[model samples]
Target: MESFPTELGVLTCLMLLAASLWIPYIVGVNTAPAGSLPADAPDGFIRIPNPALHRPWVQRAWRAHLNLLEQGIPFAILVLLVDRVDGFTALTYWTAIAFFWLRVAHAIGYITGFARLPLRPLIFLGGWLCCLIMGYAVFAARMV
Candidate 1:
């Protein structure tokens, strides 16, 4: 079989990660104290107006998941756009791979409240830079 682009593979993993990141958030919520949610709450019910009410870890999980989605959506678009225009390059491959790992680390750091000040943000910034690199590469491909 022909080899597919590595960036697409990384994108697949990122997509799966984003889809499943909610697991920890939901688990944290369900295991929280009573009165967190209505007993007869419907499926897909999420009504937490005051996130402060939940455990700190739960809040982190929610935020981590949200951050993943925030980054994942844009990353997916850029990767697909680059691939669509046949803009595959060594830089794209490496950045896509780095972005995936950076996101994983970011999620762990966020959920565990590890290094909230500097390290965590730096990790996030790394992933953001990866996206920027891919975006720039795609734009540059148009000039070639």
Candidate 2:
């Protein structure tokens, strides 16, 4: 059996994390009060109120998911770029793992309201920095 690369494993974990972040928001929406037609509805149209507004946790969950998307996309791209260029290095490997865990912490903190003020932003910054480090590794590797 062939062993998978560590970075690839981290990438898979990150993707799974993104996939699961929507659960809380969806559950919150389903349990919230029923919605109604919009004020500007012209016919038999109906629109649900923004689910995020139904609860603070739901709102945080929604925002956390959004933040992941914003950060995850670039991280994914950079990871792939590194892989494509055979740019795997100690720095990239460690940073990839760090990025995945940081995202998990960020999501949990946001959804549960555990991390606040500077803490959440700092977690986000860590993930962003991981992406930058991976990107730089890719660039440096390609220059060789």
Candidate 3:
């Protein structure tokens, strides 16, 4: 087993993922109407009205969510490997948390569509920083 930092980092990443996915579910549920939807909903209970195809935020949110899911699996693998190796550090824990925050912020900002262009880039960079930091932690832990 690794130190407490690694354990905490793993849990943080998991929670972040949960939050990331949860937001979409919450949005769908809350946005959906009572009488608007069917009582005995069929296969696809919720039929979402696609926000707007041309908008960047609409595309960005969808893309970012998928990207998060994509990278998330690898993060899990790295964390498990770290635990198996019984290794990790402060930087690792913080980096994982930072990545999660960045992802969430990016999703929120982009999905809301208020902040455009430069602000979007800044948020995007936040997510990138998260990836870079987490990647470094995983590599550093492996070398230990």
- Give per-residue CA lDDT, model 2, range 14-68, as digits (tens): 9898988988887775665545323564443212536434668877888989899
Q: What lDDT, from 0 to 1, does candidate 1 have?
A: 0.87
Ranking by lDDT: 1, 2, 3
Compared with the true structure, what per-residue lDDT tens digits does model 3 show for residues 71-111? Answer: 66665656566556655666666766766666667667656
Query: Candidate 1, TM-score vs. the true structure?
Result: 0.87
List candidate 2 stretches off by more than 4 Å: 1-3, 33-49
Task: Rank by TM-score, highest first.
Answer: 1, 2, 3
Model 3 stretches astray by more than 4 angstroms: 1-61
Clashing pairs in 1: none
* Model 1 C-alpha lDDT per residue in residues 51-143, reported as the tens digit of each score: 455778888998999999998899999999998888999999899989999999999999999848899889989988998998998998888
Candidate that beats the other on TM-score, 2 or 3, i.e. the better one: 2
